[model samples]
Target: MSEFLIVLLAGVASGALNAIGGGGTFVALPALVALGVPPVTANAVSRVALVPGSVASAWVYRREIKQVEGVATRDLTVVGVLGGSVGAGLLLALPASSFDAAVPWLIAFATVALACGPRLSRTLASSRGRAAVLSPRVLLAGQFLLGVYGGYFGGAVGILMMALWSVGTGLDAATGNPMRTAQVTAVYLSATVLFLTASNALSVPGHLTALLTGAVAGGFAGAHLGRRMPARLLQGVVLTTATAMTVLYFLRG
Candidate 1:
């Protein structure tokens, strides 16, 4: 019962944060690790379980999805799928010890990105038409790399994607959010397929099912709530959670 509740709450928090912005992995991954799942397995399970939440959030913002200036949406999606598959394959192919050692640094990097990404995006966007000249190849390359990151660990990938789009296309954070949601869904969708087929997520059906159920519920509610919540407030909440998670994990390391 305790195990179920812990993951369920984590899933709710994770899905809600993801629906509003991103950082679902920060909650879901840590909670699963705390439950004695191996780091790699936890990462895989979290990604698979959160797929529905991301999909739900994407559906909520479907009407708002639009093309980024320089790159075609289909082109980016294809690259994202390919990169995500490679990342998932790498996660399975590598030794578990390597992932354990890298967890703290990965979380720390994601924490910094979560903290600075929005402001950085805005600043770059405000610069004298600089982002307007961003090349399609550069944008596509960045998206592919981010897709790999999303597949591997995916802490604040949505924030990073938004920053990428903001800098590459001079798009505002609010305006870019729907696309961020969609692309993240794309990355996780491909990653989930790989994780389910190759990873150990199936071994813990109890935990996986609990998290998925909570995420489905939370994702729906959060999408509706996000419209009314202030962006700063949402960012603050996610940052606080991400910071605490980063510190706790670092100390654990």
Candidate 2:
């Protein structure tokens, strides 16, 4: 019962965080570790748990997704899928130590990206004009790389996606929300496939059942809230949470 509660609580917290800003792993990963799951196993388990949340959020954003430029959306999704598969393959081949050492730096970079994303988007939009800057080819390529990153680590996948979209797609931050959600959905789906098929995700502890359930429920609720909430406040929460998690990770490292 206690173990179940732990997973449930972690899931809800992670779901809310993921829906609002994208660093839910900060909570889920640590909770898994504290629950005595091995680091590698915890990473895989967290990804499994997160997939449902991302999917739920994507569904909630379906209406907004329809408004995206059709060509750009299709192209980016394709690129993201291809890139994610390659990234996942790389993850399976690389040494775990290599990624562990780099996680802190990546987190720090993601934090900065989220923090300044809005300002950067505004500047880019004004300089190149929104449509001109957001070329389909560039957006596709960038999202592809982000997909790989999401499959491999996925800690700040949402932030990275938003930043790339802001610069490469030139979408207004609020307008880009659905794109970000969609990108994350693609990455998570691709990663989950690679992880499961490769047998790399076999270590998920039974205790995580409750966590998965809560995440699914919370994700549904959070996504609904996200669509109705004020955009500014949502962005602010995401930035703040990401910044705090980045600092925490760096300090721990």
Candidate 3:
């Protein structure tokens, strides 16, 4: 019961944070692992469980979805789905030891990405009139790579996407957030399908259920709250959570 409560709280935080910015996995993944789920399996389960939450967040932003100037929404989603599939395949095919060895680094990378994304976005947003430096093809390729990373671990994927767009096209991260939520849903949706079919994510249904239930409520609420909530406040919360988790994971490793 205590474990269930922990997972539930984690899920609520995860879903809310994802809706607000993109660091939910930093909350959910560690909770699962701490509860005795293997790192890789925990990742798979988190991906599988968070799909609905992301979908809910996406639904809230549906009408507000904006397009990247150079990359078509459909095209970006296609690459994300494809890239996610490839990454999922790699996760399932690789041995657990490899994932174990990689988990700390993955978390660290995500923490760094989360820490820097907004700054990068702000820096580039200031110079917005410069012609987009990346062509559509290049942007699509970058999205694909990010999808791979998202599928494999999915910590700060939404922020990373915004960062990529900011770097390549000078899009303001805040301006691109609604679309980022939508793209994150696509990436998670694709990974969820793969994890459900090919991974042992369902081995522990109780924890997953708790997480899912909390996430659904949190996702819905967060989407609504996001309109009123300050972005910097949420980012600070997520950054702190991610930073602490990164340190803990490194120490444990």
Candidate 4:
């Protein structure tokens, strides 16, 4: 029961983080690992379990979704799907030890990104002028790479996407968040398909069920709550959670 509750709470927190910013994997992945799942399998299972919540969050923002300035939404989605599939394949093909060793660094990078994202976005916005850079081709290429990363680990992928757009296009994070949610959903959607067919993600049915159920509930609730919460409060909550998770992972390593 204790383990079940811990997994459920992690799912809820992960769902909220994804909905609010983009650090869900930082919560979900480590939680599963703490419960004795192998790192690679945890990654696979996290991707699969979080899909419904991502989709739900995207659905909540559907009406707000719009084409980012200087970028083609349709083309980006295509590249996202393709890149996500490739990332998922690589995850299954790679040795388990490789992923285990990389876990600490991945979490560290993600935690720093989450912590610095807002300030970095602001700095880029101020100095870069409000003009969008990157031609359509370059933008598509960048999105593909980000999609690959999102599919592979997905810790701070949403924040990464927002950072890219903020630096390249001068688009504000608030304005681009809906699109971020959609693209993340796309990445997870493709990754989930691969995991379902090619991975052992479902071998632990109990953990999967608990996390998925909590994630879905959290997704719905977070979407509604996000609109009402102060932006600073949300950021503080996400940053605190991310910092603690990063420290824990480093210690475990």
Candidate 5:
């Protein structure tokens, strides 16, 4: 019962966080680790669990999907997907400790980016004077790298995507929003496929039955509520959760 409650609460927290932003794994991963799952396994399980939530959030944001225009969207999504697959493959091949040391730094960078993202976007937009001039090869390579990072350990991947889009692609923050969502969706889809195919999902203390139940229920609720949420409020929730999770995870590490 204790384990069940823990997983359920974790699922609820992760779902809510995901609905608002994109750091759901930051919550779920630590909870799974505390529950006695190995870090790699915990990561894999968390990734699997996150799929439903991302799908749900994507559905809720479907209306905005059409808002993303220009040729860059298709190109970026492909780059993200390819990058995500490679990252997931790397995670499955690498030792857990290899990533452990890097996680904290990544989280810190992401947190800082989330906090200053809006200001940075405005400043960058002003400087660009219309379209952000990006080297196609460089942007694609960067997106691929980011996708890999997202597949392996996805916390605040959205912030990274937004930053990249604002600086590299020269899009307004709001316009970049759906692109981030779409990119994340593709990355998660690829990661989930890789994780499942590799058959490396973590076996924790809690039962799959309970975990799935709680995660699905929470995901559904979050998706339903997210559509009606005010943009400012949603951004607030995302920033707060991302910052808190980064701090907590750094301490735990």
Candidate 6:
């Protein structure tokens, strides 16, 4: 019962965090790993479990979704799917030991990305004279890289996306957020297809089910709360959680 509760709560937090910002994997992945799931499998399972929540959040933002000035929505979706599939394939192809060794570093990188993303974006925008818009080729290329990172580690990818747009196009985080959610959904949905088919992520059906259920509920609630909540407050909470988790993982190692 305690284990079930832990997984369920992690899912709730993960879903909420994803909706508010993007740090769900920092919670869900570690919780699953602590319960004895292998690192690679935990990653695959986390992506699978979070899909519903991501889709839910995306739906809430559907009407607000926008393309970058010169980039088409269809092109972004297609590149995202292809990049995510390739990343998922890479995860399955790599040795488990490699993933295990890389987990701490990955988490640390994500934490840094989350913490500095806003500032970095602002700096980039200022350096670009504050009115610069990215070329279509640049946006597409960046999104494809981000999609690979999202599928490979499944953490803070949305934050990274917003950062890219903020830097490249001077888009406010609030305005770009819905589009970020949609792209995240696309990346995770594509990755889920590979994980469900090729990975052993389904081995722990009970845990997965609990997480999926909680995530769906949390996603629904978060979408509503996000409108009224201060994004900085939510982002701070997630950053602290991610930082602590990253430290703990390093200490454990």
Tens digits of per-residue lDDT for model 6, 1-253:
8988999999998888888777788789989999999878889989999999988988887887877656788998888888898878888887656555666676677667666655675676577765455677898898898788788876667776766676566565566667878889899999999999989999999899989988887777776676566666656655676677668768978
- Model 3: CA > 4 A from native: 96-129, 230-253
Best-fitting candidate, scored by TM-score = 2
lDDT of each: 0.80, 0.73, 0.80, 0.78, 0.70, 0.79
* Candidate 3 clashing pairs, residues 3+ apart or interchain: none
TM-score of each: 0.85, 0.89, 0.85, 0.84, 0.84, 0.84
Looking at candidate 6, the ten consecutive residues that score lowest on lDDT are 95-104
lDDT of 2 by residue, 97-139 (tens): 6776777787777667666655776787687666545666666
lDDT at 107, model 4: 56
Clashing pairs for predicted structure model 6, backbone only: none
Which is superior by lDDT, 5 or 6? Answer: 6
After superposition, which runs of candidate 4 have C-alpha atoms over 4 Å from their true positions?
96-130, 230-253
What TM-score would candidate 4 get against the native? 0.84
Alpha-carbon runs more than 4 Å astray in model 6? 96-130, 231-253
lDDT per residue (tens digit) for residues 1-253 in model 3: 9999999998898888888877788789889988899888898988888888988988997887889977889999999998888778887887656655665676566566566754654566566644666689999999998898788777777777876776677665456768888999999988888899888999999989999988877887888777565666655654566567668768877
Q: For model 2, give the RMSD to the true fold.
A: 2.3
Error of 5 at 74 (Å): 2.6
RMSD to the true structure for each prediction, in A, is: 2.8, 2.3, 3.1, 3.0, 2.8, 2.9
Screening candidate 5 with a backbone cut-off below 3 angstroms (N, C-alpha, C), the clashing residue pairs are none
| lDDT digits (tens) for residues 8-45 of candidate 4 | 88889888778877778878998998899988889999
